[model samples]
Target: MSSKSDTIQVGMTNTFACSYLPEQQEQLLVLQENTLNVELFEQLLTLGFRRSGETLYKPHCPNCRACQPIRIPVKHFSASRRQKRTLKHNRDLSWSIVNTTSDEHYQLYQQYIEQRHHDGPMYPPSRAQYDNFIQCAWHQPQLIEVRDNKELIGVAITDVLPNSLSAIYSFFSPTQEKRSMGSLMILIQCRIAKLMGKDFLYLGYQIDASRKMNYKKAYQPYEILTANGWQQSE
Candidate 1:
């Protein structure tokens, strides 16, 4: 593992319109390195860094500090009544972990972006875009496919670390919104982490003001990384 003394070069990107919040601009502190191994990447994750393809970055907006990194303490997590009901409702769906992405997975991703996130940046999804956004050269992400009866319904892109799993991204069949596949995917990651004896399941950023990004709080008791370090949330 890379120690605190190991130097990872970082560069800030110019401000851009915030995707999650309107009327707000966003900037990112990007890791500038030619090669990043799993050990170094894992160390960066602990410091609030996240991966997008091969690039690692974190929010560095000068005017806002709303993007808080959150993680689930696998041993301490207790699903709420609503989350329990969500799991029960989707009991028929089966999931499996795969190391590579498939054409079917891309098809599902395209549909998800078109139907659910049409207004967002990833709206016009294509095969090249899908590959570039999810696949990384150094890290092999696990694609957790959730199916119903034999049909593909959801895909959760996750990065397996030495001691934890980072949920890179997830998408489901918009037609099956009733299943609450988003929450189901997160719950599945938590279970996988615990079964693997991992310490935590990183859930990326939790922006409380952004409805689309704030649902992560439901997975309590989670820890939100703050200026004072990770604090347990009820």
Candidate 2:
């Protein structure tokens, strides 16, 4: 089998203000190729690369190395007391997976960005932004939709690879804050990955300094990328 390093070409982007870290700058090592596919993404995911829309990139910051790629070893994962409670709490909701996006998805996503992330970079949500950010050309992303008696409450955008599942992004009805929908979606993804016989669930980057983006650590016994290789974290 040929290695990823042998097949892919990469280039670095100009430094920009870090989205997660306000005081830092961010740069990305992006894949420079015309033909990108899920099979190729599987290899990139193993190397700490992530997808935003259709672009595949990994952090290559100059001054800071705070953005660490994190993944859960699905077979070995053991949920904490809180996670178990979250699962129990949302047991009443229905979960289904689809391979396409809809206007309803955009409505919920817009509401999520506008209400919860107004102060963030994706604020003033527009239809164009949502479509561009979510849709991809190579493959149709999986939509894990959660509902309450026919009402849409949460959606988790995920990418399915041969050996792993990458969580692209998730958003919930802001009005359902008490449901802990965000964490619930993640827990659901972990379960789905295990059910699909996948080895890992890629939860994107874990930036310890960002309070809002640091919750992936609660998933016990995750592996984070390092200079040497993926290291297990307790």
Candidate 3:
């Protein structure tokens, strides 16, 4: 597989925005065993990246902190009445928290990619691509699958950080859109973090204006990591 790895000294001079920049200086990358780890994550608790529903990250660029992490504070979390309905909505579904990628799992992935993200890069993720997507963490293949008997409905990929559980990716059966399996998966992660006594469940960036990313904003009492500091969305 192709790889990109680097480690830089702890100075702003070595920093740069990766994906979100015309100018590169706001983000820093740390090397752990010559691989890129979350230097920004260390700043997450302070830089405004809130955990909820995958990874730790802040907006990197000339300026934009909308890329905040959305995390659930388990001890203080209360399932909203709507959230409760979402869980009960999928009660018929069963789950198995195992590793990702299997014959059954792959087929489900194929359908989800084909139906849900056809216009996106992973529209037709090769087996290799799918494998890589879930294999980057210490928890390689660590994931959960929501199924209906023999039918695979959705997948949630995650990693456990020092003080948090980070959700990597989640995709549900397009045919079962009414099920809201995506949100249900996050809800499950919140419960898991609570049981494990972890402080937060890290949901990746919550970009408001992007049609593909708008739903991320709903995972509340979310905190957005900004250049100034962590700010509550509402």
Candidate 4:
């Protein structure tokens, strides 16, 4: 559940300011729901809303709104040569969705954190912690799986909103590091969006200059939300 004390603030931003930085941080009420129907979610996602815990928040910050909700313009997206190769590398893979968590997922997640983000939160997440982070009761799962020969290789947990999909978290077997599986999973989602005729991908925060968060910017022809409205960042 989101804290009632949660708040956002916005202000003037220089060219170097982050995309999420808003010029007018305003207050907007948070919505708590036990479930989000898929059709209704599509609408909210298009409007820039994201759900965390049991709370849903759009870009409701004070004096700022630069962090625009973004989605992959899938119909227009082209896989780079490298992305295509990555897809081919995992061609032996296929996937299916399952309800509830699995020990295999938890183990891969722990390995991913320990190897790629030793300092991240899931390094030692308990079962409850993992559930709260990925299997929240508020949102139905829109998970994607990447596997080969029926052996699971990766997981991308997302929540589908009205206009776009919110990628909450993803992980892979660190042992499969050579596969570029993380990027490949994202590429798969872009195709899924295109097939579904969705307009955006809603990649969360892309902290400018943060090495760990840098990859989010490559989805060119995308827009960044600001005080005025969604503006192309291309």
Assess each prediction's global lDDT (C-alpha) against the native.
0.92, 0.91, 0.64, 0.66
lDDT of 3 by residue, 151-170 (tens): 87888876656576777778
Better of 1 and 3 by TM-score: 1
Worst 10 residues of 2 by lDDT: 1-10
How close to the true structure is residue 212 of candidate 1, measured as C-alpha lDDT? 94
Models 1 onward score TM values of: 0.96, 0.95, 0.74, 0.74
Model 4 lDDT, full chain set: 0.66
Instruction: Give candidate 4 misplaced runs (Cα > 4 Å).
Output: 1-48, 57-68
lDDT of 1 by residue, 1-234 (tens): 387556667899999999998878999999856578888888888899999988999999978999999999998899999999999998888999999999999999999999999999987999998998787778899999999989999999999999899999999999998888999999999999999999999999999999899899989899999999899985
Q: What's the lDDT for candidate 2?
A: 0.91
**lDDT of each residue in 11-123, candidate 2, tens digit only:** 89999999889999999998746588888888889999998887899999999999899999999999999999999998899999998889899999999998999989998
Clashing pairs in 2: none
lDDT of 4 by residue, 114-133 (tens): 78877654566566777775
